[model samples]
Target chain A: MRRTAPITILALTCTLLISMACAVALGPASISPGSLVTLPNAWMIIWDVRLPRVIAAALVGCALAVAGTAMQGLFRNSMADPYIIGTSSGGALGATLSIVLFAGTGRPVFAFAGAAIATFAVYIIARQGGKIPVETLLLSGVALSMLLSAFLSFLMYTAGRSLHQIMFWLMGGFWNVSWDDVIVAILIPVGCLIIYLYARDINIISLGEEDAIHLGVNVERLKQILLFVSAFLTGIAVSIAGAIGFIGLITPHVMRLIVGPDHRVLFPAAALAGGILLLWSDTLTRTFANDMPVGIITACFGAPFFIYLLRSRMKA
Target chain B: MKPVEVIGIDVSYGAKKVLEAISLHVERGEILGIIGPNGAGKTTLVKAMSRIVSPENGTVYLNDQNLDSFSFREMAQQVAVVPQGISISFDYTVRDIVMMGRHPYIERLSSGTSRDLEICDRAMQLANVTHLAGSSVNAISGGERQRALIARALAQEPKILLLDEATSNLDISHRIEILNIIRSLTGKITVISVFHDLNLAAYYCDRLIMLKDRRVYAVGPPEDILTTETIRAVFGIDTFIRHHPFTMRPYVLPVYESPAALGSARRVHVVCGGGTGSDLLYALHREGFQVSAGVLNIFDTDYATAAALKIPCVTEAPFAAISPGARKDLGRCIDATSAVVVTAMPIGQGNIENLRILEDFQDKPVILLGDGGNPSFQDCTGGEADAIVRGLLDRGAVTAERIEEVLRVLHGAA
Candidate 1:
């Protein structure tokens, strides 16, 4: 197990790097691999347009994947994804509200604030004697998701002609992602690293709270730290990417099947896998259907694969 | 000095009080067993000692320090708890589970040290789970899973260990295996185990604290705490208490349920002695018959069984000839009962009077489990008791080969 861990990590890092380079080469106004060494236009296009978009996609993917893994570990439920905790739904609601009320100028900022507030609400609702019991957290997350989604539906109902814009944003993409977006999305890897530092404690918590407490884990504190960091990561990712789904939910599961459930190894692997998956999905969305949102491509491809994996795992 | 002392602690789950003002001290390096019927607060007490559930009223002291003063890490280093009935759905291997015990000591970035691995290896070896180190915890049997969890607790190397019904899921052999491991740790680690099985608790625990209705009913060595009267009062069931022949510990056998509905059944007087009538007495009592036995010597096994079953029995002094007063008392009992059963008890000189009482009941229906054996072999009075049995058979008393047939004849007639 020890020998396999380092090797698995190295392999994932390599996969992420290779996939990024390949993704940069595949978009519209395609430049040949050999000409890219000399051509100034290709360099200009890669640096000014493609590089920032790819960076944002990678950040969003890594953030969602790491957040999903942490949430799954926090709740000790296999089905606990980033969206299960109301972060994405809250982000979508904030983005739609901003688009309707403020004309979409500060949509990312409002979305980030909404994600943070939603997580804080869930955390406060679930807290009892400083401990956030998993069942209570899960229920609160579900309830908050339901409440926020109802509000979002009301906004969509009022959005008549502009409903197309709201719906397209909801489908999620990185069409106009900029250097400013990349700067804000940098917190994804930073938040993931913080959560990774507590991977051992998270592993113990996954055994159950009482078990973690007896094993000397400050279970309440660990829950607070991991949930806050993951929520922050999800907030930044959702603010920029406009609620990309499945990357966070599916990446951790794929990594877990390959590397086992030890969060120490699974966290980083999920981040790398998430980055590679989103980078390629973004490249395909841009190359094949220029107007299509990356979120549609992800759900179009990721959901069927997730069901296949689930059915196969059940058979095993 | 005692290492753990819980002083007047009360605990509640929401509005329902689970434990109230419970005070107990666990001596250092002793296996203290907690026993009680369901809802008796046994698990609550263990949780209190481990500091899992904070007390509403009082304090728990670990060594000389207040338990509340210790940080989570310090408390974990001193105390470890094996919780009951935890289901691990994740596919963590046995070694992965046990290695979690080192979480308190390991640094944030460090995976684990050689010392941690050594401790895990020793704990698994002590728990007899070294061979299962690679197996997923959920894939193992209940007994093996229990040992793996115990191994995890042992890896923590706590000075005090608390188990909450840790062996309830195990069968007898596995239960013994786990208890034997715990027994060997008696002098090194203080153990407070909640046991569902009274017999196992009596056999393994150095001292027992029996709980009744959220309070300590009795606290002492098993011999004193496991008395039949205590069992009846606390558990509300009639039980037979006897010293285990090897360990000399109190062993309890439940005899019958409450006789609320059984009191209305027909009374059957039994004539037997020397342990032969014990099964018949228990079966009849459990089958809802109001049973009475006769003239058994005070020290006879049959007498103990009858007393345990709470059957009304006429008795005689041990090794003494049945006196005329006792015979008259036996006669009164025989006259009152509707039927009588004579079990295959050997009649010695001292108890031959029981056979003579059978002659008085000749007019009443009597079922004999003679099994065609000569009564002279059992007769100590040189064919005197044999002649009484033969005469009874000739007088059209029913002859049955087994106790079941006797019950059939009597219950059928009823």
Candidate 2:
């Protein structure tokens, strides 16, 4: 188990850093290393524009992945992802509304708030007595996300030029990347990850509620804390990066195969894999075009992989 | 060894009260058998004791300490539970599953230690399924899986064991084996098991607790509490209770008798012979035909069956010849048979009076296994009996061979 851990982490770090460097270096301007000494814009572009964007992608990726991993174990589900439960849509609607309605308000802040609200709403609706039932959470997430999406589209349609202006944000871009946004993204995700790191208490919980209580876990309280931490990360990540699909949905799944369903390892492994995969996806995005949204790239790949995972694991 | 006690526990499923103010204690090193009719709240009681569902009205104490004061790991160390079924949807290997019971002892941050392995290994050894150490728990037979589950619970090294109808899903052979295993644990730990099978309860449990309508019906040593009246009240089935010849302990048999009016002059008696003829005597009694059995040896279950029927039995020794007094009484019974049916038990020296009925009764229907049945059965037949069988059959009495056909003939003839 120890050997498996370091090997996968090494593979993950190598993948993330290599992809991040490539994504930052390879863009529409395609500035050369030699020209870095010559051209004035190259240094600012590399350091300010591409680096923060790259960092933002990595942080958001890691956050979503860790949050998704914790939620899956807590729910005892293999396919639980942020988008399916309307977390992203909720965040997207929040981001779109804040941008269109609020006027010059920071997009990431509003998006994070939206994501958190939607998640807690889903959590509350799904709760029965002291338990957050898997089926209820799953169904309510679907319902609330759709409801929020409709409201978002209504606001977007009603607005004139602002609707088109916020389109790229809806499309999910890391383009107008700033150092401030990068720091905010990293901080929110890191804090959430630290809390989830403590949720190994959830493993005893996944055995079932009664078993958990018998084992002396304050099962309900632990669940509330975990959901809050996970949703906080997911909301903050979505606000910063838009609804980048595959990292949160698939990273946790890939790690569960490497490690058993113990959350202590699963949550960290998921965060790492997420951060790496987002770096790779961002690289693929940046390598293709400067202005393309990472969400499109993730959806195109994540959907098929989700199907594949579901099929393969159905037999298992 | 102080018993684990559940005190004044009340359990509710939503608003419906399933178990009311109920309390029972399981003494250490005793296999306390719990028997009741369906919906007797036995499983609910176990759940409450285990703190799976905390009792709404009362507290459970382990020794004298309040059970709620213990941590989950602490509670696990004191009690192990083999729930009704092994719900293994995941294909966890038997070792992984068994090792889960070591969760209380296992280090949270690292793999299990060798000491843990020894405890888990000893549990598997006790359950006698070490060969299934690497097998998938789901693929094993019901009996094997049950034992594997027992091993997992035992791996907790708990002082108290709670089982909720653990053997109900098993076959007869498995049931016997499981009960035997539980019986073997009598001196080591407290075992509270819910059993629907009363006979198994009688064989295994030193003491039995009977439940009815969410309340305790009776609790005592098995022989003292398990009786005809209790079975009738709890299960609403008419039964007969009689002592085992070997153990000198009573067990029950369900008897279904159809109520039919009979004329005062038409009283009847059956002088049944042979051990296998037990059912025939029962069928006769249930039909409102008076039944007497034996000169039967007490070693036979049929003697118990007969005694249960409240028949005026001319019982013999446990493994001995019939007494002269029994023989004479048996003759009086024989004279009263409106129709005599000789069940096809291989007759021998002690029951020669079973054949004596043939000569004295001149005119009546005679039923035998005919020629194709066990010829060993013919060994005890004398000259008068054979001639009379031939004479009676020829005299318009039916020569029915099989017991079913004889019953049919009797039914039509009556």
Candidate 3:
């Protein structure tokens, strides 16, 4: 039992830095490895362009994984990924609405605003007083996701000339990766990770509200904070990258199946696993496809395995 | 004033009034037992007492203070309840659940203190479930789970303990162990427990509360509370009540059916089951003939009724399974008796040899009830049963309808 977590974090940190370096330095017209370090134009491509995008992927992956682990503990159900319950639905709707309504004016900012508003709306509608039953939250998230998707479709139908562009973005991508977008992704996810360290409180909570109250936890206050922070983190990430689906849902689940149910181990394990998974996914999308969006790549690769999980779970 | 008193408390679930303005008292250091039939509101009474369900009318008090004045947390601190539904949906460990009981005591912004842990540990030790301290509560045996729940309430460190049918699911040994534990807790605390088993209530409780028709029917010592008349009236069952030789406590024996129901029986001596004695006697009586049943306790419902009907009944004190003395006495009864009938009562390792009495009077008739098609006789046979029962039947014994038909044949021969 050589101190499991610090070593795990160190391993993840090494993987992340290696991926960042590769994301910047590898391509068809590869910048010379030596020139890449010194040449102003080459450094701009490596540092200003690819570096931000790689950082954004790593941050968003970390945020979703944290949210996934927290949601799992909060619901006390293995299946409760952040994307499962309308959190992603709210994020997608907000981003779609912001793009359709405020296009060419302020892309990331309005999309983020829209994401926050959608999350708040979903939370208010789904919660009964202060308590949100896990079942209701999942159902509402799915229901609202469909409703939001329909609304996005309606926006696409009316936008005419911009329809193709909106559709393309909605398919999801890291193609528009830039330094500013990277900063947006980094700031919000980092803030959410700070909030997610509070996920330990959820370990005691998921047992029951009454049980949590007895354990000297302010159960209501903890629920409010977890809900807001997860929503806030997911909203900002989706605002930048559209709805990249299974990295959050599948990564945390696989990590849990590997490491066991304890969230203290699960939270960081899922974050690390989610980051690596998306990094590899982004690499595969960029290198293998014809300018393929990251979301399509994830669904194409992750969905078949996800479907197999559902089938096996149903059999069990 | 009593430390705790109920003044005309009533509880109703929807339109059904389960408890009707019931009043009671619990002085400090009293081990009170509540005994009743299945739907007699035993649980309703305990729940109302604990304030788990608020009574529709009347008041409950602790130390002359009205129960309404106390919040749930305050009441929890004063009179902790180990509720009947001890199961949890989540897979929390025993220590985790016990620690939850210390809720009313834990300091602000901290986990439990050393004092809290010590209290929980003491509770587990007292309940004799210390081995299960780290085990998942959902996965443990029912007895272990019940002990854990009790440990939780004990950890609450309340002055009064309220348990509702808490020992019902346990085995005989566990039941006695739990009852003794409850009885011992009365040194400084008041313990109120509802029990379905009357004999257990007799052995352990200091005072017994008998309920009928949503009201208190009797309240006293077990000897006073467990009269045959009360059992007949409250439970609609005829019973024989006697004093135990040692404890001198009232012992209740439920009336079992007789062998008189059979139209004809060569008097079959059922060395018999614990309860099979009743069916044999009933079968013998219903045949409109006299057959003796004996060496059974007067508190053995079958034995008492046989005595009442002048069936030459023999008796002994309330004991377990069958002892060697009981076996020899049955032999004496068999020497004078005719054929035998083995009722379909459970024939396990304890009393399996008891049924072999027909094998000895090898020439005598032996009828085993529940042998053929009847479902009641299902427990009578096993792997070697065909040979065992067939051997007895071969010696001129057979199956009869409730043992009465066998006796009619004996009467006809007479």
Q: What is the lDDT of residue B386 in candidate 2?
A: 54
Which of the numbered candidates is closest to the native, going by highest lDDT?
1
Q: What C-alpha lDDT, on a 0 to 100 scale, does residue A300 get in candidate 3?
A: 80
List-wise, what DockQ does each model earn?
0.72, 0.37, 0.07
| True lDDT of residue A299, candidate 1 | 84
Top-scoring candidate (DockQ) = 1
Q: For candidate 3, lDDT tens digit of each residue in A1-316?
A: 1136567667877887787778666654468878866777887777776777777877778777777677667666555565656566566666666667777356555555555555555666777744566557667777777887788888888988778667754667777778778777766656555655664466556655544543345666776677667777777677767777777678767865655444556677777778777777777777677558888887786678767765775685
Residue B390 alpha-carbon offset, candidate 1, angstroms: 2.4
Q: What is the TM-score of chain B in candidate 3?
A: 0.69
- If the candidates were sorted by their DockQ against the true structure, best first, what order would they fall in? 1, 2, 3
Question: What's each prediction's TM-score?
Answer: 0.91, 0.85, 0.66
lDDT by residue (tens digit), candidate 3, B298-336 = 456566556644566545566555567767777777776
> Where does model 1 sit among the CAPRI classes?
medium
After superposition, the stretches of candidate 3 with alpha carbons farther than 4 Å from their true spots are: A1-33, A102-144, A161-173, A177-201, A208-229, A246-248, A251-260, A287-291, A297-316, B1-124, B127-142, B145-170, B177-303, B306-402, B406-414
Instruction: Candidate 2: list runs displaced more than 4 Å.
Output: A94-117, A120-137, A157-171, A188-199, A305-316, B1-3, B85-152, B166-188, B196-204, B237-269, B285-301, B311-337, B345-360, B369-377, B380-384
Instruction: Indicate the worst ten consecutive residues by lDDT in candidate 3 chain B.
Output: B372-381
Worst 10 residues of 1 chain A by lDDT: A129-138
**Chain B TM, every candidate:** 0.88, 0.79, 0.69
